[model samples]
Target chain A: MAFDIFHRHKLTISGTQAQALEMARLRLIWVGMLMMMGYLAIILRMGDLCLLHHKSTAMLMGSGAPAETERPLRASIVDRNGNILAVSLRMASVYADARMVHDPAKLAQELAALLPKQNEADLFKRLSSGKAFVWIQRFITPKQEYAINALGDPAIHFQEEQRRIYPDANLAAQVVGYTDVDSNGIAGIEKFFNKRLAAGGKPLRLTLDVRVQHIMRQDLAAAIKTFHALDGTGLVMDVNTGQIIAMVSLPDFDPNHIGEATNNEKFNRATLADYEMGSTFKTFSIAAGLNSGKVHLSSVFDASHPLHIDQFYIHDFDAKDRPLTIPEIYIYSSNIGTAKMAESLGPDYIRDFYQKLGFMQQAPIEVPERATPLYPSPWREVNTMTAAFGHGIAVSPLHLVRAASAIVNGGILLKPTLVMPDNPDVPPQGTRVISAATSEKMRRLLELVVASGTGAYAWVKGYDVGGKTGTADKNKNGRYENHANISSFLGVFPIWHPRYVVLALLDDPQGTKATHGFSTGGYTAAPVVGDVIARMGPMYGIKPRMYITRDSIEKSMKPYLKEYKEGQALASVSTDH
Target chain B: MRKSTLLWLILTVFCGIALFHTSQKVHDERARLAALNASIAHEKQSIRVLGAEWAYLNNPRRLEMLAKTYLHMAPLSAAQFIRIDDIPLRAAPAAAPAPQTEKIAVKKISPEIQPRKIVALERPVTMKTRKPAPPRIFKKRAAPDGGTATARNFRDVMKSLRLGVE
Candidate 1:
């Protein structure tokens, strides 16, 4: 009877419908859970393959191309003298896949607390957003990477990126501007040559000598601080070859931390700021009158008092009581005398001279980022007089160097340059804007200024140096501030041969008790040029010759000058009549 | 049946002769190949010996020492690195002279021939001096003969001393 009952229970047809429905539901739920696990496994394997492989397709990590996962290539930058100036090496940019992020709030808190720089809330917000990828930190330090790696978060990933490093910290900061977080050039020569860097080729070489650059930066920076000055800029150039060996601008930023820098720190004052160059402009004006055959070395112009114009007085810095010879005018830096000399030449000739010197044009270099010189629109009598003493016109230090090089480089004008291998040391394609004779007289007169006049303190013992001291009153609010002067010194070395030209300017240098409470070119910027010349003299093999005799300066002029007997007879009538 | 058996015997003999001739030809080719292999081995041994000699002669340290002592010169100074702009732009650098191929004359010493000997001899001079003061006592002489005969008067002397000396 029990066996028969069990057999009957196995065939209970009335309950089989509800029993079959329950069994099918259980099987369907199990199948759904298995499919979901399989999809999760496949997604994780794909992520592992992509993150581990630094291939081009793995560029989902972002920032230009895929991060260089293994032995990332570095780009090099070299100076003119074949020295390494800056380089970009392989470094890690740590990121995370928020979709793979486990305990997002906890990981973000850990990273934020560890990084010290980023806010925990912001990191938590970005991490919890369930993104495929997000940059937690870029250009992280090696020590920081080790600490983050120790946290051992499987979701966190690292993408190797190139980080720029300037070995010579502040030497050529303005010229070799820094790169961004993703290693893209943003300013200066670095920006100018970014395309060459992206290809991972050899480092782009510039025409800067890191040694000379260091000397300039050190000298200018010390002067900038000593005078309690706002800013400063300095540049040294080869007159014959038109190579910028050294250039520096103060209040410069560290290229490593470029993003945090202000505009003043990033400003390339040497090539960007155009200032009224004061008596430094005399170098060009004298070159004009002498080149136009309107004046000779013995030609006399009166600096007896202020030269009265239409409601304007062109006064001299060191006014002479009577008429002065051309040499005396330069020796004294007589604004009134130079103004008369400019008046005699006429505005058309002066403006043509400026145009020839490239002063009316943009900064002539390959950097592609430079300010054009501010010059008089039409050459007027007032423009001629004011421009004579560096009042009516303003120019960048690069233009000033270019114009000075033209006046002294045997009268052959050459534009300045920054690139090296491509230029191959070719001098600028410039015409003879001045006679060789005028250049020689200008060199002698310049030497006299350093030896006996305003630039007397800038004299180097053995280096036959010549220069002009310019202490121009800065025009702040349409009127000049007497106390706030832009002191600059335009100097050349071995004047008999004229090999190098230097210009150092200090902006708003205040008077100091250390400077006898006087902030002029001689006190503020002249010493910087002198210091650069002293340091670079031996480096360039420009030794103090045993004899830079007067005969040497007098010898080059012999080929083009006549005796002053004719000029002296005319000088009496020149002053009286 | 008799003709079939005779034909079978003749065919077997021809087949045996053919195998013998073919074996002789195969042996000849094997000997030639073995000789060629021996020649190849000889060439390989010669190359190994030459390679050993080259490794002996080419020591990097020695070459570096030689370069330091004689061949290398210091780099030119910036004063030496003149701007192309500074140069007159008229001429290029001078060319080096052509390397000479010197022919060294060898004096062959034949292995089958005897080497020429260099002979150096002292001249024999006999001076008859007056017996300076007769010795108070005459010393006994072992032999008065100062000729080649006396020189060869050891335990085994040659009878024809003149011929031996010559």
Candidate 2:
């Protein structure tokens, strides 16, 4: 039985070995089949590539017919009224790979002659440096490219590039800005609207008017030259829409040759330059009091002596005494009275009010270049006194605008913007700081400044002009400069209806003989506002005002005084901090 | 069995299908590329048109005329406008119109002089030439020859338009 079992086991083992051999044979057959299939596939693909197609993909790529790129042509930029500000023009940029060049001297001579800017010897020396590649020229003119192409050297290359051409050399330079060699925005609205410029389907339209820009630049340039100003800035904004129509900065750059401009020439002063904007801050002070129900158009404060505090005195160019009315104080721009009113409103309320007015924060705009207004980290009493007269707290011309805009644009606080906001369907939301009644009264007072007070020279007969003049001594270290002054004027025109905000500022302006050795805001800046208004008003179809009636203003003031008097009698005695 | 012939047949069919697909891919890519190029070309053409318009519009003489004609805005004066303030207010007309008499003048005409009268009217040659220009010399002869025929043809056409030609 054991011998029989052993024979069966041997048979079973042989069967298993045979099965394994069969499996190996099948595996070999499968491998052969796979190899045959793969060989067939490879042969077919190769024939299809080398024979059937007649051209390889690599070869096709080397040839220019179907290059794997479909770059969109760049878009043009226009103004609000469809004036073309900046537009992308097609051109060629030339470069050369030294590694590919056979004759360095020959290539250099040809390139140098084609581009007269470089010497042939210098070009040859650069090519002989054994570098892999060298840039011959960027943003070459079409004629230069043609002259280059006539050389017909194998090593020479031309890359298609976009060149932004500015039609108006210096008009709206700060507004349109200039593009870099690679067509990237470097400053102004171009820098702000970089992504939109790149996305190429739709043109970016600004609120700038080229004609208006020319008139302004022409006027402003004359002003800068006349005043012996180190720098100057001017802006016109649509108070209704917050559209910056035209913004000009002195020492302006040429967009066509923007790369050649210095850092100072490129700075946008109207929007980015910051300074102690003097008594212009007073507009906010009175607005705060009116909003707080503690003051009225008839409110009085003695302006004869400077409002004296611990080591600080706030007084105007000419002092008044015996309790002048609010309109008279503003018309005269009495810094002493303004400081007292700011005290009446107190620090907390003023700080909060400035905060709501887009001050004490980074200015809002699409452009990356924006300066934050310098406010006291700890709001104090002395800070309040200086801030009231616009000394301690430094702000940009834009801040002065944001504050003054509210006073002119009814009692509502509208955040100023660029880019003529997308929603034409909806007007921008603004917070009401003072009642319409107070706003009406303020308009009358501001107009009275142009008509009868410090800004008297700014009065143009036909226009219902209203504006405030601001003159501050520049701070060298901490204290204000007695000689070097920043003179600025903020104005709202057709002041009865108020549609536009025009601001003019001159930095370190020297007094001229015509100005009677005066560089104050009224003398230096107010006249510019008046000229801009007279020039722009008729064009905008704002018919000239035949008369400056004081009826509506007086009516608004009577009601304002009675309400404020009752509130003052019953209000909290101590709201100051 | 003729295995090589069968293999050749399958390979031929496979090669044909692959070629069709590759051809289709190339054609589709070409169509896409053409469309993209066309679009780029169209954009470039449009920009050229806009630039031409801008150049024409921004001509200095044109702008000066516009400033004068529109808005009573004149060349900036030293007396009316001092050099102290030049902040630009861009609410003004950017490029003034052609200042056509039509553009600036109101249409309220006084009925006193009955406007300028038309002196004379040019008479057309009536199948006869008093004075025929060189280009129309042949036309004068042709017109005389074809006048009766044209009048009859027009009568027939009018009949045809009335649906009676058939």
Candidate 3:
């Protein structure tokens, strides 16, 4: 059989037939080989599917859920107590495919009815413009979206967009700030932490307490109305941590309606606008004097007459007309006494002291709307005298509050912060601006002011309130206007162990009948500070020491106050400047 | 050889059927998982909206207004607070002996006290069983609106409720 297979076979057929038969045999062999190759390919593919491609196939089939929804475009902003101040919500922005819209006039009418703010004529123009897409309304309410959807038009559609919402409205308008339509932070802390907020994780908690903010705003607003002031600002700060608990700027605009706000309403007076802070600066000058050992509480300064320095004459608003002890000088708000005290300390020492207290530069706070303090350059002798009386220099209310906090909070000058720290239990450290002994003496002297001096109106029974009142004539075009003045008060309560520092300022306050035509700080702003402390004392759970009496405060300050009379007919109304 | 070929053919058919069934089941599960994910996303969005609304509703200014209108309450005054030590202690009760015994018994049963050790294993165990105490009876009192017969009137009930009787 093997020999026969090797032998060639002969065929009895014509040449063409034999050739055709040979071709047919070759084609059949080719077809059979091709079929074997196809089977082999199928086996290889089956093996690949069962082993090499298993993971890919399983992933494709099993992971059918859509990729995780995108994270919120912006994070929320909360108060110190975790109350929502600002949030970002996914909202429906309705638009139209103008090319597909039919009866532009009719559709415009329907949309105008649905959206009261959208004008019918404008909608018709947008619809008839033949543009492929046009926005009908942005950030519509859910009810409006529902109503529009009921129209059931194929041309109309909605695109989900992120919108920033300020839930507290005008309560914390200047601090929480507001965002633009594109969810971009525009002002206040919103503008300051734009990048961190855009990253979108946990909420950005601020140091503000909304309840305190409400109280401050309500009280400040009432004071503004009562005194007929043009504008006002208020601030509250933690003495140790420098956390701003409440900040209010009057004539503030609602963040929810940013477009309707005027430029004046948008101005953050507390942190941005600088003013000649009048008598509030006395707290700093007295602290500097006491800290430098240049002037003790018992030291006497001649406030009997105006003192001449260069072309300017420094005079007390209500002249004491006698050599005044340091405590009596502070309580009387004597400008001449303060100027003489600064003169004794010299200009260099005063400038360096002010620099250490952070008065020479912009206030160090979290908000971006901070103002650089305006002070005389070259530190002239006259500038030192005027500055000691809170003139020839200007600073924001925030700066005053921060400095006052340092003076009352054991001499630690902490940088004010609007954002709460991750661990609020640990207080941020501060630089020492004065000796603790000096701060204690300053506390006693301040309490004495409220006890029997010009700031007598600021006294709140049992709260041991201590403060200084200032009434500064506003400078306009380099000239001081007498009638137009800034009245302010700096208050610290439970003065023995201070916890909070509050400052209230009124711009161009007019005197009312109750004030007897005197719009000085003692008559106008001191009462406001008193009211704020009276209410805040209870809200903060600070137990009032009924044992603390005016007599006790005066007795403790007796060594510093020479010939201080008891129940001295509450110092004349316009006694402080 | 024919038997083995037949056996392999049957096995391949069974494997094919099983693979198809599993893939089909996986597809159904993926669809359900997708649906759940969608609903979860929706619920999260709604919760954010509700949070915003809650903040707006709880705004201090609004709360103050509501409180002024509906609640007869004023802000806490400084006079309301007093030191804890200022509160005088209550006078001694007339029936103090019974409470004294109970206090001693509580001390005896305290976890801090260790049980006495047995000196000898041969001692017989004595189990003392006390008599069960009788259950106290609670008597139903008349409704604040005089009686249930007259309490059917809704206005009267509302008036009584407003007066804080119920």
Predicted structure with the largest lDDT when compared to the true one: 3
Q: Write the per-residue lDDT of candidate 2 for residues A1-577, one digit (tens) a residue.
A: 5565334455555677767866877898999999999999999998898777865654664433534374555677777776666777767788887788889988888888778788898888778777777888887877998888888887779988777777666777776778777788878777777787877877787777766666667677788889989988888877766667778888888788876888888888877777888877777777777778887777788777766788876666665455666775676676777778878886687788777787788767656668878888898887876776677888777767766777788777777676766677798887876678878767877776665556665676657678877888898877666889888888888887998888888888787888778888888888888888777875676765443433333334443332233212211101100
Q: What's the CA error at residue B9 for candidate 2, in Å?
A: 23
Report the lDDT tens digits of candidate 1 across residue range A272-294.
88899888888888889988886
- Candidate 3: tens digits of C-alpha lDDT, residues A1-577: 5544222364456689777877877898999999999999999998998789987765766466556465456999999999999999988999999999889999999999999999999999999988889999999999999999999988999988999988899999988888899888989888899999988889998999999899889988998999899999999999989999999999998888899999899999999999998888988998999999879988999888899867887887777699988888888888899889999997687788889988889998887899999999988989888888899999899889999999999999998999888887887899999999999999988888888777888888778899888899999999999899999888998897999888889999999888888898888888888888888898889988766777777877767666646645435656677
Structural similarity of chain A in candidate 2, as TM-score: 0.82
- Order the candidates by lDDT, highest first — what do you get? 3, 1, 2
Predicted chain A of candidate 1: TM-score: 0.80
**What does candidate 2 score on TM?**
0.70
After aligning candidate 3 to the native by TM-score, how far in Å is the CA of A378 from where it should be?
2.2
> Best to worst by TM-score, what's the order?
3, 2, 1
What interface Cα RMSD is found for model 2? 6.7
lDDT of 3 by residue, B88-150 (tens): 332223355688765764554433332342222233222233221222222333444455323
Where does the lowest 10-residue lDDT sum fall in candidate 1 chain A? Answer: A568-577
Q: Which residue pairs collide in model 2, if any?
A: A219-B86, A220-B86, A223-B83, A303-A320, A304-A320, A528-B85
lDDT of each: 0.71, 0.70, 0.84
Position A217, candidate 1: lDDT: 82
> Largest TM-score belongs to which candidate?
3
